[model samples]
Target: MSNKTIKIGQLDMELQSIFSAFEHHVHTAVDTAAEKTAEEAVKKLKKTSPKNKRAKRGKKYKNGWKYKKTSEGMTVYNEQYQLTHLLENGHDIIINGEVRGHAAAHEHIAPVEAWAQDEFPEEFKRQVGKG
Candidate 1:
């Protein structure tokens, strides 16, 4: 008899099933870790010196602003999910939106000048810094 053998039984199918199960488990673990890290960062930011909860408000729009269309002709309104905070330095920071625990969340503050500049360029200039 030849030394080579082919298994036409359940073993081949079971091996493939085991690998697929492992792949799913790893994917879940990685996703959970990333989400938890982001949540922790938000928690830390909220716990800084002020130690007071902020109130919710509507999006602050600039005066005389008109809606413009994107290249694809989608009307671009300054629709953003944002949280606004006043800092000791008299500047504003508006954070981009995120889904937190099945609800939309936006956390922003005045001290985060760099993030405000980079993330919300148009709003930052008009609202916070020199326009």
Candidate 2:
């Protein structure tokens, strides 16, 4: 390699361009990984969510899983927002304003959360490696 000398202003511009390209690359990889994880979380949630097969209108919690792209980042959520926490953590079954028994939690979101914690890092590495 031949040695070259550059002026200060030119050096600054060159460094800026190089940094910009690198920043773009890193951001693209991170965004791709986040999107993949979000999609997978939705799919897994749909699979694991409780469903009422007998419902005439077929309004199942499994079908309520959704993902959103936000200014902050990706997000996976249930369209049946009110039921998520109750279903996940279980709640007392009440009848006529009196407690009867407890409903067992199905444990859907927790498992997906555990999976994502492991999945995101691997996905990011794979995406970056694609370069």
Candidate 3:
């Protein structure tokens, strides 16, 4: 019988290449997923936003929703308007130190949150070819 020795150097190199490829794929998939999520969130926000009756023809609250990508992830926000937080959380419409009424919260983020929770994992999985 002839003695045979296994060479692990080639196997290690092949594994390294495979891991590198996998890393690249994962990064690309995550970036794509993030962008999609942001876009979907903005769309949902716009669809669910409360219409401002007093808004001018070119100044609609729904059109304020926008998104941007950050180093950690994507963020959905209103670039032109700053009342998103108040609109989402609601506030007491007080007059002359007396509580006249309350403005009900018009939720937009909650739906987006639910959507991301329910859909993000699957989307990421699909993108990464694990679905």
State TM-scores per candidate.
0.33, 0.87, 0.82
Q: How many clashes does each candidate structure show, in the order listed? A: 0, 0, 0
Provide the overall lDDT of each model, using Cα atoms, as 2-decimal numbers: 0.37, 0.89, 0.80
Runs in model 1 lying further than 4 Å from the true structure: 1-8, 49-131
Model 3 lDDT vs. the true structure? 0.80
- The model with the greatest TM-score is 2
> Least lDDT summed over 10 consecutive residues: which range in candidate 3?
1-10
Query: Candidate 3: which pairs clash?
Result: none
Task: Tell me the tens digit of each residue's lDDT in model 1 across 1-131.
Answer: 24545577966886788788767765555444433433333343444323224434311321111233345321222222121222222333344654333322233333333432343434323432221
TM-score of 3: 0.82
Q: Which model is ahead, 1 or 3, in terms of lDDT?
A: 3
Per-residue alpha-carbon lDDT of model 3 for 2-110, expressed as tens digits? 3545478776876687788889999889888888888888888878888777667444678788889877688888865677787889999999999999999988778
Runs in model 2 with CA error above 4 Å? 1-9, 57-59
